[model samples]
Target: MCNHLAFWFGKDPARMDAMFRRSGLMREKWERDDYRAATIGKAIEGTPNVYDPNFGRRVGIRFGTNPGPGPGVTSGFSPPRSWDDPTRLAEDYLSGRCVRVVIDKCYLYRVDSDKPERNDCWEPVSDAWMQSDMWQLCVAAALQEWERKEAKRVADNEKAAQDAEENGEEAKQKKPEVVPPVFPAMVNSALLDTKSQSRLFDDTKLGTWIDGDPNAPHPVRVGNGLLDLKTRELKKHSPAWFSTTKIPAIYDPKEPYPVKVLDLLKYVFDGDDTRISVFQECLGACLSSKLIWKHFTAFEGDGDSGKSTLLNLILLFLGERNCSTISLKKLTTEKFAAFDMYGKAANLSADEAYFESADEGRLRELTGGDWVYWEEKFKSGFKGRNITKIFFSCNRMPKFSDKSNAIWNRLILFPCENVIPADKKDPIYMTPEFWEGSQSGLLNFALDGLDRYLSNRRITFSPKIVLAGERHRSASDSARMYLQDNFVEKDHARVATHLIYADYLDWLAVNGYKGQLESNMFGKEIPQLFKSAKSQTRDGVRCWIGITQTTSKEDLDFRRNIHPTNKERARQRENDSRGHTSYGQAYARLVEGNN
Candidate 1:
């Protein structure tokens, strides 16, 4: 039987030569006759490359000096036919021999071809292939290997972090958790769990809550934990008042308070013991807002008298969020001005007293606890009672149209008299760090005052304070000055209302008092200054009795020379009642009496 190896090799020797050249396995010399003779000899010798009836032919081709079977031939010397087997092709990808390229989410490619122009050699690996039972089984095997490597990497990182922490080094920063918006009704306890708890305090009564016992039922909720106010140490928690934002109540109870009460008082009041006491009382009243109710504080002084410092200290004690800044003029003049005062425990004004006129009714209502109607731009008007304590630091005292003593009664004046010297001024005290450090001491001091006020229900003032208040009232009342300068006390003596009003206008202009009251308004305010006097229009001339005008030079000279003696005042009153004592006659009588 002739060897039919040519039929098995196919009738394409040139094609076989081209494949060998491309694979870099071409021999130096190759003739079809030599190839056929070698194959026939191997078949006859029953070599490994010889044909077997059960397993088919094992054909081996020699490429140069290295003898090996070509690609498709089933010979032990030939490389595995991975391109023909899908499992082998996938395995090649896992081994990293085949470059895996993700084309899109749904499809990927295993690129075996290096040619840029043609994609014919690229194998499309679809999501469908990954989802198939056979491919899934293959992927599962690959996933196990990958998971093992990932687990080792995670363990190594954790070990490194642990070692660093043990060595007192800063560990890697973890991702931050999201914070929720704070609610108004929530308890602001440092220990409370903010996420789980639906409520913090039982009721909305605003007060300080310090963490007490660990096991006790906490009265306030802070950041998702309950703060037991009964058993926990007060010093552990910081001092914080009710504010729009949450502040930690961390205060060092042991540290000495940096600011001395007497020093502060001396700085603000300039050794005026009267003003110092009144300021203390005012502070107490402000601290114990619930107990003291509606009294407001006013600080009047020249620049650099520590007015802003004193107010800033009080505001620091109250917490910045608990206070708002608004001019007293705005509150009394603008309709919607009170809106800024909502949720604030204190309202501060450092501006100069610019508003010459104020609505007395509004000022009264604010301090009298009447519901104040306030409106914001593009919003409906709302009404709320003014629980906020009003404080003002000004070069000039605020003026009001309401002559009734209601507004005066609510005001507590502290005259800042000590003008700080340029060389002695300490700017560090105004910094936030100084105030923050003193918070604990200041809070304790305020609490003590609050306790005293709660027990007594009164802010006591010194006799000097009473006198000072009167002086302030007199200074503020333009009519009081008019009464002092233009009128004299006499039983039958009277002053023309028009003349008195004219004198008042002149006094206002000379003293540089802003704004003017009409004659009728001036007449109305006179009764407030001199409560004993009564207005009467006699024969078309409006006059006030027992208050004679200094119409003549003799009357003016007598009024100016009159001393505060009962006998002399009585004689002067008699002379005035008798009618028209000329200046010359009065001088002659004085000279004659002396002789």
Candidate 2:
């Protein structure tokens, strides 16, 4: 009889099996020794090899000086012919060497002839049989895991900083300089929500809202300021007007004015005319309905020219509660933050007096329809929240040095001449209440018109035009002046400077000039295109022709050197037939006659 022994030897059997019973292989220890190379190929087959532990080759193992067993002959340390017996095969163990095996259901190994030998017919012992390739796999996987975590940490740090900065900015905005610590007498205890104003004030009975009182004060709270709507104020001692001056209300009851005023107020606050006109006149200029219009509309003139009056009139229509007022001195970015926290506003107006203190970029953004950041906590307080409109007034137009032409173009200069003197002294009659009433009705009508018009028509805006030659500039300037004053599409320069060009026309015809006078009209008629041109040279040339505008002194010098010469003179023969005089003398006489 032969003595044969076989037992299961597994990877990290001690470590893995201790953690979980029946886990024959101590995977941690086996994997640490790179035994996967020996296991992967034979793991499913559960076979062991003598010469090649990976199980692809076969060879006999030597135990001390003992040669391995033969298949037919019996040896003392080898299993007997009973190796074919179920009981003997199930109880065998390898002699002195063993490679870790993945036990699926039974233990097996490769024989010299490539036959499978079961556990009962084999001897098992622990010995190192780890493959180098398995260690490489473990190292690569561990490295990848570590790198992923590192990358995530870096990304999180950057995001945290960004969030912190955003939060800080919002904090600054939430507390604007104008937010009051103490309540003023006229201020409403509760601040009005802009969103609700449109709904609550939707009804347009101006008299009902203010009671038609000539001296009544209706104070409404805005974001950071209080708007006072006053009726007529007695400037000095005045007796009750002789009871003889009362007039009957002549308004027709059938045609209520509420719709008109509501509509007009909508336009004063929400009309996208600037955006529309810009899109219409300029190709591809990105216009966002939600953005602030980057231009300014200035009503410049002496005090009484309706500049301030217009501002008041606009507010009357827009609703005193919907507007934000900034003193010219306090209109700073710092001040804007205070306004931002009250949330968003529908209209922002500042007196010309504050233009000097404003941050150019900030004002440009306000005018251009961009939102200001509130900068604290992670919330966006007010953005894309209102139909923002800006109004500015000055005693005179902003000097070129004080603002860019881009800013100037935003303004719709409403030139107010002293209202034909007769109209002024006839008991000038729009009491604040009266004016307010008229505005309420008229503006409502305008808003309805806007609501209807906007649904059907795309709001179009004129594009800034660029011009090319100085000779063509007057025509360009005329067109630009028209566009700047009015948001319409037609070339009004021909209409505005009609008298100036008419004079040119008369001068040309009287001089017996044969050259085309209307040739320069093309550039003059489209001064906005030149003004919109990114290049000054191009815009300057068009302005010069259209509106008496001139090229810059620098540009004039550059163009002067490149001015054309009379090449036509050289083309003609010096001795062409029929003249009774020399060509030079003939030419001189011709020039003198024209002059």
Candidate 3:
């Protein structure tokens, strides 16, 4: 595989994989040993660019591996603000609470390195000169802090003496000079603490939006920055609010679509414009804060299909900074899974299988943009909300235990139908360097979708996509699909429980579904799907009321005869609420697969 990935990425396999690492592509370890060297992007020595929490922006930040203003030029701050005096910056640094520090390299690599055994390690440094300089810097910080305190004490004493003399009383006793602790202890006390109220940045300090506050107002992030949803433009700067991270996607109208990405997407969607548009809009939506209209996306297909290609492209489009990976099982069961997405713009699972959700409520909380209570090891619980778009793909849709329309309502399913043969699968799509050239174009492609979504405020799924989605979602809960396929509503009806359960098992097995609920749970949840349905006893046998069971092969045969014409597909989209339920009568004409 590495031998063939030579299309414009050059012959260096490690460099190709290094680009993949920087672009956030996850790969298995079955490849050549050179692939392991991908982390060289991390191991390579590089200075970190300077970051100022005080300004919440990069100042003279020369990012990447190149050197910038390292500590050698530590006379004053790197970029002097018009209103900020460089002398004041120097004074604050001397006093050891200037709130300015080398958060990143003087000029650097991202600070995502593995933590050392201890912060103050001597193993990485053995040279006398460097060690002496480090010790001198720490001592200087402490001495400056002590001198600053002594000067303040003397000034306060003078003020007290003057006030006492003005009132005709004896001067007050002077306060003692305070001892300055080590730099680490000073940090613990509140000096240079971001948690202090003096900070220039904060979370959601942009604050809530809606006056009535029906659903939580998730401040939207879009395009290049936090979006002013009303104005449909990048939000103007606000001192009260700061987004900890920005979506790296930049919208430029003049940029064309990434040729390779567009080609693959068009092929995967079968050139269906509606499905393609939904995908594009979905890509755009991931850059924003949680919007209820922004439904979680499920790419349903087998491995050979373009699911991985499209999924990787999406990861590249979102950028590594704003993305997190957590599978559905983890997000539903792991206590701290949701917290993994604290400030992320998107959460994706590379591969997920359908399972009975351990906590459907957590899934709802994540997808609904409701306030989620998150906790991590040794940390107090933090309650917060995010607009992190959720995406996952599966070859075979999981058989879920859920029996409600809620989970079904919060999804936009894109059927990955077109399969790429093993011999024909393109290695270039997975090549990390391929995306760098396409970045601007991909950004614009996503921006086009954002414009459409901002205009209408919702994504419309095509009928074909609806049919595909319904088939997959219904496959997850076979009991419900069985109800749709082999039953109909009626005023006078009673089907024996044994008879209903017996055929349901046959249908469930025949439909390739896994697992079954006991008769009691099956009977318990039936009413949820059928509003008028009820269970009762008749002739000394358990029975269902208000709905009749029908295993008529005739309807299934008739369904096989009818094709999905343009008119039929258009009819499917005519009723948007058609997803919640399609009765057996309608199911006869619209039934998917062998049902």
Candidate 4:
């Protein structure tokens, strides 16, 4: 805005445009040179030009004054600059000297000046030296309105004359000739000089870019200057023109930023540096445009252990605008939930209501960078690759039924087992004041973690954290947990097959594990649990080898005389659902018939 204003307030607009354009060319040269700082600091004709000057004087100052340190104060202090300075455009701004003038949008564009299409040109009386031309525009508009009224009046009178002639009566009035409005005459060049600006740009290049191609069918023109993603040194560019979301926080790697915010990671991960290391990598991954690590982090276990704090901190890091809070369950169940994933850097699902969710391949597709369809309400749907990183913070471990590593491998867990006691808990950590000056330091910390992880190109967790992650994953698989609790892998250990089944039923009954009735599920899921375990018949009794159950409970024969065959049980279920005879009575009738 200042640049455009400065160029507009120039005494000779053409000379100012030429000078600024020259400055732009010099800037391009400086960027390509090895010593940009040295070249810019030097002068061109006694003018130090290596600066982004204000009021068309972005160049270095010729004469300046500085007040030396007063007794104890450090130097670098100066009184307010006087208006006599060559660059002082303060008067023009504060006094409203050029408030009524309309500057061309083309002059406002400050990047990639070589492209004529990028310039926003004057078109259809728009960006006219508007204030001065306002009166003439009003007069022309009024004249056009009068012409329209005259045309309508003549048409009505002519119709009446036609009707009278048809009736064989002489017409009372002659046909009135409608005179059309002519274009407004040009003004004198002597009074207002704008001819030079007309020749500054090619007439054919008008409305080629910012205003779009005038001849095309529905030409699209971008309005706001957006952050240029390619070369934004922390996104401080003047005219980006496309991106909507930007990191409001600046990233400076060399600055000394002290942040205690990362202490939340230590507390949540039980102060385990290895798990914290994996966590730091995850933090850094959130900063990227696309999924870098390609995994969702699950921060599980006890409340009041800083998981929420860590979540808020990450939310702060990736601004609330850049991160989406839609749950993973919604991706499969809700209408158009996938659309929320677009344009977001990370998807943070923190609600525990759907924490234990059943993923139906959509979660894998979303985090795996697969191009998926996004449906927007009342708008044409489009396909975009999912770049959003996913994170789930829940008290309960997530439930997934994928038998493969598709879902399990993509989940990394950070255990929040260490609870902050009532007395030791500090409310200050949760307050806004605690987060100040933390973004820069947190960014640096994440960068360090990123560097370490990229060395191997994969996140490495210590054996303990790896075990904890697997344990958390097994929370949904009762069979896996049952195996872990009652059995141990051994070279030659053996147990009667019936005995193992009998013990599984007792364990289920005693533990009161929900949704689990210990009959057919054990037979089906047990065999799939281990690799080498197999069945063998020893002296007429079948036995399972290579595994042993660690229990002292006496095994009751699961296959008793009352026990029905698998086929009979399945038929009984179907019959019950169809309102047939009771299964016990039906079994008795079959036995009596055999007798």
Candidate 5:
């Protein structure tokens, strides 16, 4: 027989109570030391077994190989050294050997006052031990059952809530609200309708070469007008213009994108026509043939100059067919170019507010040349290419070093000085519809004009304008041709230089100059225009005119001359009065002696 007594606690209390009620297990409690015992059986009517009831303790198993008679007594068995040893009483409790004794508290085990049965039944111990153990087991069991049921209920509620959330999301997606496409009056619904046969463009109307090489990765869609993909999902006040006018077609930087510009330049050279007729008005400036300006354009301006507003109008007029807009902050040059330009969506830069001045290095890359390279700067260094067009806005003009070769050469400067303050400008923001309509009106007009001009002419920079006037025709031609051949190459741009000697000569002619131009003649004009223009230069730079002259002022000032008639008149008057020899002979002597 086992020497230990097994005491089980944490029994189901409800079940235990039912058993107690049926079996007459409840009785008056008696105190033994710090604990209380419930009386059980007529044999132990007033014995203490249960402990202080209110202070709860974790119900678990305890094994004593030899139990003492009273509640607090351990039968000489101290706590074991290790909890895992099987032979040890401490080990048995820890190894869960005691925990596995499943107690059915609903059934009471009877212990005879004078007799003992097998291990399954309780032995006749102190009345106190029997009474207290019974009550504790019943209470613990009922609490355990309650906890289990409560956990199940909580888990079920959470699952139901999660399922409802998922269902709600599905319902929303099924009936999503659609956003109507925005368009100008000129881009009628008929153009977009299925049955309308009014063809906006056909193969012939698109010109001979609408799409480029079939094998080319990104092909141009010729017949489609610009397109704006809109949805209610987007936020308001978002910028959305693609190309702007201020940027140039070809930029010059340390590294040139000769390879990249080649393919697009081919299309421009081939005369691929492009036109913009948005909102029933042609852009005053037209863009014809994707070849001339196959690259992207950015527009930068001061705050509230309607940079984003203008771009949005362009998108609206383009009508979700030929154009799309992105704010500048999101633009990644390499990633943007790999996509299609002629698709219904035109790639655009995102909305961006400019700093007071441009970062000189970045401005150089954007406008300087077709490509820019810096060796030690940014390890991989920026190598940008084929930036065909750009529209950007800045609060102030870009700051650049006079010595920086890139930015000074590439940028085309245009100042958008509004006649009215931002607050006084037309209230285009009264309503979305009104704002959209008016902006489309202005943008379409400008784009149309640009398209027409670029399509018809190969714009060559005329240096003749540098020397404007009807009088200096021959001299102007000589100066203009020399500057072109010697300075500006066919591939390079024509810079606005007042340093042209022909311009200086024109200034002299227009101002009414005396003799033919001479080497020292620059000294005369310098005292005038140079004061202002010279201040614009940095220190240590010398200016040269490169002009030839025919005469010298020194030669005219120093040459000896004879005044024969005047001297003779004086001498004749003197002689009439004093009989003096005439001075004509003296004058003749001076001339002859000098010769």
Candidate 6:
């Protein structure tokens, strides 16, 4: 019985009851001692009586003196007798002697509950019991109880909600909706997609508010409204404007600026008011390359003139990533070099090398907003149009091979003539620390320039700059120089076209000028110099009738001394009859007269 109880209830009756409760079995209120006693009593009282025919009508017989040897039992053999009577077995069970009773090889047992049998209320003790239908009943009961509790909980919740709604107390006790924080927009315009921009900003606005920084596409400091460039309408600002680009806190318009606008402009332009104005206008154009097309800037100065420093400040002010570096030589020599300018607001080159005359057409195209094809390494070529504003700084202007005025018309030169002495140079001006410290002031200055450019719609150049450009053009062309020196007005003595061409070539060789133009080219360019001059053929000789060769003092003296002899005059007349002069004879007479 103890072993059976250990296997069924895990060695303790209290544990058995706890397991039943956990499984929702609803254990009955009964002590283990009273249950054991009642179970043993029932088993004993239910025992049946046995009859022995050998005992001669006695139901249960005890072992008496056997009457000698019976007929069935020979000598030393006796009739079998019951080992113990049923009454004695019953007494042993009541006295607790026989704790367990076996009937038909099975343990005596009974369910202790007094109520009607509920198969669902019983839990299985082991695998054998689980295989029976009782374990399924227990599982079904557990699930049903769970469903009941859930239904009750839901009903209570619904009732509470209904009661609150009817009383109007929910409105008074409700929590407020939370609003997320707003931050500045910071993203490069080149990187942003149209969908993203539309979602962040209002589509209707007067003028597009472009943040001056090329690296940062989003506006960090904006007023209550912004303008739309495409629509030309004003729209209110939205708090949803957000981007990954980080704007420094110093750029806040609400904060005090570190440097005054005038002082900042002076620092960049070195107190040259003309340069300052021109540069500011250019800077404004750089802010929005799409608005202004054509026109590039050239900064002409030697080292230590602060031109490079000025460029660095501009790059810092505009976001360095928004600018790209490219050499003029590359722009002309490389087929796909223009690809580098894609998505860039400004392209800067310092100390650029000279370009051949062939590059002039490409340079014009770059500034003129023409579509150009470019290819990257190991990729297919594509066509793209760039509006990138160009800036070049060099010690001297590049020599252009094109004689046309196309290049000159588009170039705006700012002569940085003020060289900073070594003693007075500011070592920290170009340092990173200086850029970080003065970013706010520089941004404010650029904003003012932007406003001015938008208002005027065009940049105006000073007279000094115009003169400088002309000088620059003249210095590069030897043909222009030769014409200016040797050619005179129509009132002077006329020269034949062949003689002038010969003199020009000789002058080029003597001066060691490279890449001299051919005679046909010279003929084409001469008309530009003497606009009123016309060509004529006299006796089959080509001559320019209107223009004359300028007479130098030495040539005039030679002519004065040569009251040409009658012999020389006859020879000159004979040569004139042949439709051209014998230059050798004319020179020999002059030599004779000098002697």
The prediction achieving the highest TM-score against the true structure is 3
lDDT tens readout by residue for model 4, 370-442: 6666676665665556657778777776577655567777778777788888898887876657787776676
lDDT of each: 0.51, 0.32, 0.56, 0.52, 0.30, 0.52
Query: In candidate 1, what are the lDDT values of residues 5-32, reduced to their tens digit?
Result: 2222232344233323332333555346
Task: Flag the better candidate by lDDT, 3 or 6.
Answer: 3
TM-score for each of the candidates: 0.49, 0.30, 0.58, 0.53, 0.26, 0.51
lDDT of 1 at 95: 33
Root-mean-square deviation of candidate 1 = 29.1
Cα RMSD (Å) between model 5 and the true structure?
32.9
Task: List the RMSD of every prediction in angstroms.
Answer: 29.1, 35.1, 18.4, 21.6, 32.9, 36.0
Model 5 regions lying over 4 Å from their true place: 1-289, 292-308, 318-388, 402-409, 419-432, 435-447, 455-595
Using TM-score as the measure, name the better of candidate 3 and candidate 4. 3
Which residue pairs clash within candidate 6?
187-217, 205-228, 205-233, 205-234, 206-228, 206-233, 206-234, 207-227, 207-228, 208-229
Q: Number of the top candidate by lDDT?
A: 3
Residue-by-residue lDDT tens digits, candidate 5, 1-595: 0001111222323333433432223344432322222222221322222222221122122222322245665667556432112223222222221111111111112211232211112111232442343233333333334445545666766676677698874222222122122223212221122111111121121111111242322111111122211111211110011121111111111223233222322222222122111111122222322333322233334555544554554454333334434333323323333222222223444344432233344434433334433222222223324222344444443233222224333333222223336566656532346533233233333343444444554322323212221112222233322323233222111112222343344434433443434434433433232222231221222332222222233422221112332355334434532424333333333224323
Whole-model alpha-carbon lDDT for candidate 5: 0.30
Candidate 5 colliding pairs, count: 68
| Weakest ten-residue segment in model 2 by summed lDDT | 237-246
For lDDT, candidate 2 versus 3, the one ahead is 3
Model 2: lDDT of residue 17: 26
Model 2 agreement with the true structure over 1-595: per-residue lDDT tens digits:
0000001223333422222221233346444435644443334244332222333212232211223576777665665532122222111212222222211111112133242211112212221112222222222223333445545666766676677798874222221111112222111211111111112222221111221354444222211122222221212111111000101112222335554333322332234344323322211111112222344344445554444554665555444433466533343446444343122223435346623234555555555545454332333333332234555666644333212344444544433333324345322322456463463234223333433334544333322211111212222243334333332332222122322243333333433433333545533444444443221222112113222222243532333233233123212322221233354344333324323
Give the better candidate number (1 or 2) by lDDT: 1
Candidate 6 regions with alpha-carbon error over 4 angstroms? 1-271, 354-358, 435-458, 488-495, 529-595
